[model samples]
Target: MLPADDREIDLKTLKFVQYYIELGLQAFDDWSNFNVVDQFQTASLRYQLYEIVYSLATYQAVYAPSLRGKVCEAMRNSIEKSLTPKVMGYWKWESLLGKWSLDWDPIKKDNIMVSGYMLKALALYTGNTGDMRYTEPDSLPFQVTKNAVYKHDIHSINKYVLRNWDDSNFCIFPCEPNWNYTACNVIAAAGSVGYDRVFNQRNFERRRERFLKHLKEDMCDESGTLLPIKSTFTGFTIPGILGPVGESVSAVDTAFIDVPTSARVWSVIKHENIELDPKSGNYKLKGLSGADFIDMGSYMPSTGAAFLSFAFLANEYGDYEISENLIKQADEVESPIEELPTGSLRNKGISVWVGGFGLRARLIRFRDWTNTVVNGPPKQCINGPVLDGYDFQNVLVAKAYSPNGEDLELVLYNGRSAGSFSLRLAQLAPNASYKVSNGASFVADQNGTGIISVKLDGRTEVFTEKVQKV
Candidate 1:
């Protein structure tokens, strides 16, 4: 039964690999932009670039034709210089930021924790070159050339800290701030290489306990029905549904209100010490611990993500679906189901790909606001302009004309597309259903543009544009 015609398949795979590499090279002008800063966002990006090149360097036996010398040059110029001891050891400076010169700022202000995922990119990309050293301040080099890798100060996946900003509830990021997913990839991404210990101390045991306690107490009702809680991410304080964050604060404590999540709930179930109850379904961990659950007017995009991630979490924890109405709630958007993303599509109709599974979770607020004040009088307002009454999670493609007559655009970011389809629309001419199709394939490829068949063999194409309406 073991057929020996594997050559054809192997050849086909090799061709596809070659084609993909060619696409990257073509997009970058034969890899000319190797040293460019465009790709530099986190140490992770550089690390990934280098890792791709390094893999090509060693595995060229099969794909050697695609790994050009320019690629190697770019890799060397961008990442190799950052491996020195002083740069690596400095806790305040994440060497990965060398590309942008932004210096190393932790995702959150209080903790020494940097991202573990970033550290992994560095180790994988630089480990074999014997470039990393004991540069971290006060600590010795992680290694001398040819020395075995040691337990250096790196990041961990399951990191938690006590509530900062003077709050009663304690909260933690599954790994660190932003990227949220309490899954196995985090564990592997933290310990993939032979070495284990990184800069951040092991925080899993404690975080696990607190999370379970919060789930039991805040995420359920008196009868044990589950409530959608997201207090840790958003940082609103009441009921700890969101935790106390900048947005969590209002103009004044007395007149303040918790931010609202686009999601809703009809029933409240009780679990074991779920500290806070975010009535609004905000994305905070500790804040949700304090508030009582709200009955959903209906399913909302903002809350849909909570249900998705939490449902998966439940399944991971051994709970199986009994009735399956959760799916109906998740897929029920006003638009035709196939064309409408789960409120997570960007104006570009693009999905987020976080952790390793590439699921869209962390939504980006392109404008950095912490630098300025957000609330109160103009003179007192310092945080960059906090988004005004905007819920990023539920937008798909909203364009209300601005006062000046230009289109003000908004799009969804609540979740990501996870299939093999597309939705093609020629124009937004109303009184009609735009062309629709499955969007999974394009999403998985991280692509956002394509052609669509409108009728029997009839189709049209459109490029996603982040444009203002005229």
Candidate 2:
């Protein structure tokens, strides 16, 4: 088993995670209330769903490997929400102006914004949990209307994304009809890499060279700065004045598949957009205009959102000093967090979409994002003891995993009122005697399942290891 100190999670960070978990549990049914309003697409339902699933999946991969059910459900809900007419039917309007016909099927054409995120979520769910439910035929159904339904699943989505890449003259396709975005394509590329990782396929590998070549040549300017948008019909590329926002987002996405390019792009962003604040002795964003300051979610000026993005990128690249400094800058300007009944917290000033970025920045370790995408979760965590069917509302799980695929470790907090709760443990050695941290011992049944009781007043840590025979 790993040392106890290695698995320790502090109370503040625990609550931060609880916040996203609680949000994810409710994301399936009621995502509209989480600030799902935007002039652009940032704060839309689909985007919010993507952010929520992304946050929850990351948490599952790193901290709570036992929470696979919750993450999978959230991913399903996100795919369902993305297929809704209101969320994806915008393609109808875009198709009118473009060469394609009005097809309500969102993923069949050039909407990488919808398809990319959905692919990422599905890939993450399957990769982390090893669940193959999404791979079934017509598992993801898009109901355009009462009679018009489009059948799709994980395989179909992957095929469509690859096909779109193959068909596009730019090699990187568009999010809307003709508007190509570097950030969105990066998301799609990362999703493709994720899919390949899970299925042991080289779909992305075959197209990797051309994708990178076009991404660098067609989407970037003379200085190698990533441009935000390009028009396929006119072949017009937007300038990189919004480099801070675009580069930061792309840095996180690109790191999943291509670490070297990600590092190089991040170096440029740091040199151009970041500076040392001599007054506070912290790193802060520099050379931002009003356009750059606008939060993509709310379309309002928010220095905090910008800071959060930079912090997220910094964290992804293992720049802890820059990440911590930028997070402090965000906290200084962002609204105070409100505690929820379940011991979770939320910021009323920022949209939930933006808040998702904050959660990622806080929880993600250096290369955790890339590692999760490229390698999936650790194999030991997948095959080891799992805490299933725990009381999510009352017991806040901080860390729950098996370090060596044989032992169990958990750190939990009282989410609400202090009380005793029961946790179901699965995947143990069958009928084996085990020692518990709470001065107790139990033997697993023939089916390799057992229940352990935990009393949570504030924080509780538990460890269960098999009793080695002489």
Best by lDDT: 2
- Candidate 1 at residue 91, lDDT? 31
What's the lDDT of the predicted structure labeled candidate 2?
0.76
* lDDT for each candidate structure: 0.25, 0.76
lDDT of 2 by residue, 210-308 (tens): 998998898878877777888998879766436577577777887665678788877877897898878879876777775567777776667788888
- Mind giving the per-residue lDDT tens digits that candidate 1 earns over 155-234? 22112122221232533233223322222122222222212222223333334345445433543446433332334546
Please report how far candidate 1 places residue 30 from its true position, in Å.
Answer: 10
Tell me which residue pairs clash in candidate 2.
Answer: none
Error of 1 at 336 (Å): 24
Model 1 TM-score relative to the real fold:
0.26
Each prediction's TM-score against the native?
0.26, 0.92
